[model samples]
Target: MTDQPTPRAQRFAGRRVIVTGAAGGLGQVVAELFRAEGAAVVATDVAPAEDVVACDLSDDAAREGFVADALAELGGLDVLCNVAGIQQFAAIGAITADALRRHFDVNALAPLMLAQACAEALVESKGNVVSVASISSVMGQPYNAPYCASKAALLLGMRALGVELATRGVRVNCVSPGGIATPMVEAAAAGLPADTNWDLIARSTSVIPGFMPPADVAEALLYLASDAAASVTGANLVVDRGVVW
Candidate 1:
C-alpha cells in the first residue's frame, strides 16, 4: 500500500510557537507535535530540561521573564499554547486558602497573564492562543474544588479574552480534555483519600471509556491553533469524548 498521509504536515511552516509546561505530560506532546508540523517552537516549564527553559509560572516576575525569553528566542510569536497548570486533589474540609491560592496561581492566573503579555505580537501575526483547561471546568469533580474552580476560571478568562482580542485578529480558545493518561492525573488519582467515592467521581467521566492519550489532546490544540479554526474563537473545544459537549 502507498504511504499514509500525515494530517496536514508542515501546517505551521514559518510559524513561531511558544508552549509552556513543555517539560512533561501533555505539554511535552504538544511541543513536539508543533515542531513536527514545521513550527519553530520555544518551550518552558518549572521542571527544567536541557532543551526546556525553566520558569516558575507561579511567580509574578517569572511570568514576564519567561514571556520575554520565549519571545526573544522566537523573534516573534505566531501561536502560544498555554499548557502549564496545577492539578491537585483535596477534600473540601481539608482545603485551605493557601490551596486555593496555589491552584489559582498556576492554573488560572499564569495562562491569562501569559496571553496578555503575548497579545500584541499575536495581533501582529493574527495568531491564536490555546490553553489546556479541564473537563472539571465544565462539571465539578468530587473533592477537587480548587482544581475545578481554577480551571473554570481559565476557561472563562480565555473566552473573555477572545472577545477583547477579536478586533485585533487574535483568536483565543481552550481545550478541556477529559481524563488524560498523564503524570498529573496519575498523581492526582494517587493522592485521593481512602474514603474517595468512585461512583461520585464517575458522574463526570467521559462517555468513551478510559483516559485519553496526551497526543490525542495535542491534536485538538493543533486544530484550534491552525488556520482550520480561523473562525473558531471564544470557544472551549472539549476533548473528553462528549463529557462537556
Candidate 2:
C-alpha cells in the first residue's frame, strides 16, 4: 500500500504577514515559520536574499517605504513580526554615541515605526504583532548596557501598543529569549574582550544551561501569531529556558 502524504497544518492559511529583519538569524526563522503555516509573507532586511526585500529598517523613509511596498505586494497585512535587532557589547565608559544610536534605532525604534506603518491594515484584519525582545531587557548583563536598555524600551512600547490597540481588536506581544545559538550571539561573543569573565557570566545566567536553538524562538513567535493565542496580548513570553526566573 502506498503511504499517504501528511497533511500540512494551515494555522495561518489565507493570512498576510510582514516580517522585518528577514536576513537575521531569528528573523529568518520567524519568516519561514509564517510561510510554512500558509501565510503570505513579505520578508525585508538590510541584506537581500532570494525572495527577501532589501530595505534598511534604521532609516525612517526606508522603513515607511518598505511597509508600503510590502502591503501593496501582499494586498494587506494580518501579522507583523519585528524580529530584527543588533547587539553590541561595550563597557559603559567605552561606548560611543553612535553605538547607542545604532542599538536603539534598530532594536527599539524600528519596530515601533513598522507597527505604526502597519497599524491601519492590521486593525482592519484584526491582526497581531510579535516582537523579539531579549532576556537582557529584564536582567543586567556585563558590557551590554545599550542592548538591554533598547530591548527594555521595545518591550515597554509593545505593551503600550497592546493596550491602545486592544480596543481595536489588535494584539501586540513580545518574546524575550536568552542566549540562542545565532550568528548574532556568536558575533557578540567574538567581540567580547579577552579579559571578560565568561565563566561568571554563564554561571549567573545559564540557569537551565546551554544555548537555545533558533527554532524554539520561531515556535514562540508562531504561537503569538496564531489563533491559539487570540486572548494573549501585551504579553512577554520568555523563552530563555528559565534564565529570567
Candidate 3:
C-alpha cells in the first residue's frame, strides 16, 4: 500500500488573531483553531479570563476598548474575527424597537466598531477580517425579524468595507453558516413557542439533517485568514450546505 502524504505546516505561524465571544461556542472554537494553526490568539468575551478581556460589544465604548486591548496584548493584530452575536425571536407584530436595536448593537454595530478601530493596524499588516454572518441574512426567517435584519446588515457592511479597504491591502470577507451547534442555536430553539412548528421552518430552509458544528465554520474562517486566500476579498462565502445559495 502507498504511504499517505504528510500534511503541510500551519499557515498562521507568526500571525496574531482576535476572536470575539471566545468564552464558548463558535468563538471558542475559532480561537482554539487559530492557536492550533500557530497564531498568537487573543480571545475576548463579555467576561474576563487570564488572557481574555471583558468586552460588552453592545456598548460602543467597550467595543473600542476591546479593540485597543487586543492590539496591546498581541503586540500587533493580523486577523480580526467578528463572531459575537445574540439571537432573539419575536413576531413582526410583537417586535419592540428596543429588541431590534439591541440585536443591531450586538450583531451589526459591534463588528463595524471593531473593524473601524482596528483599521489602521490591519492596514499596516495587510491583514484580513472574517465575520460570522448567518443563512438568515439571505433568507427571511419567520419570527426572527431582528436577528435576520442584523445579520443582513452585517453581510452588507462587510461587503462594503471590503471594497473600501481592498486598495489599502486589508482584505475583508464574511461567512454565512447554517444552523451550527452553539449556545445561540440552543437559545433560538428554546425561544420557539409550544405551538411553533420548527419542522416547517427547517423544511423551508431545507438544510441537511446533521447539525453543522462550530469547528466547521471556524475552518472557513481559518482559510480566509491564511495567505492561500491572498486574492480573496469582498466575498460572502456561504457555508450552509447549499441553504441560501
Q: Provide the TM-score for each candidate, comma-separated.
A: 0.95, 0.95, 0.92
Lowest summed-lDDT stretch of 10 residues in model 3?
A: 200-209
lDDT of 2 by residue, 189-231 (tens): 6656668878757744766778888989999999999999999
lDDT of each residue in 1-245, candidate 1, tens digit only = 99985775888999999999999899999999998999999999998886798999889898898888788888899999999988778778888899899999999999999999999999999999999998889887898999999999999999999999999999999998888999988887765788988999878877888889998999999999999999999988888876775
In candidate 1, residue 190 scores what lDDT?
A: 63
Each prediction's number of clashing residue pairs: 0, 0, 0
Displacement of residue 90 (Cα, Å) in model 2 is: 1.4
Pairs of residues clashing in candidate 2:
none
Backbone clash pairs in model 1 (N, Cα, C under 3 Å; residues 3+ apart or in different chains), count: 0
Candidate 3 local accuracy as lDDT?
0.86
Runs with alpha carbons beyond 4 Å of true place in candidate 3: 1-8, 197-200
Number of the top candidate by lDDT?
Answer: 1
After TM-score superposition, what is the CA distance of residue 163 in candidate 1 from its true location, in Å?
Answer: 0.5
lDDT string, candidate 3, 94-146, tens digits: 78899899999989999988998899999999999999998888888778889
What are the clashing pairs of model 3?
A: none
Residue 69, model 3: Cα distance from true site in angstroms: 1.9
Cα misplacement distance, residue 195 of candidate 1 (Å): 1.2
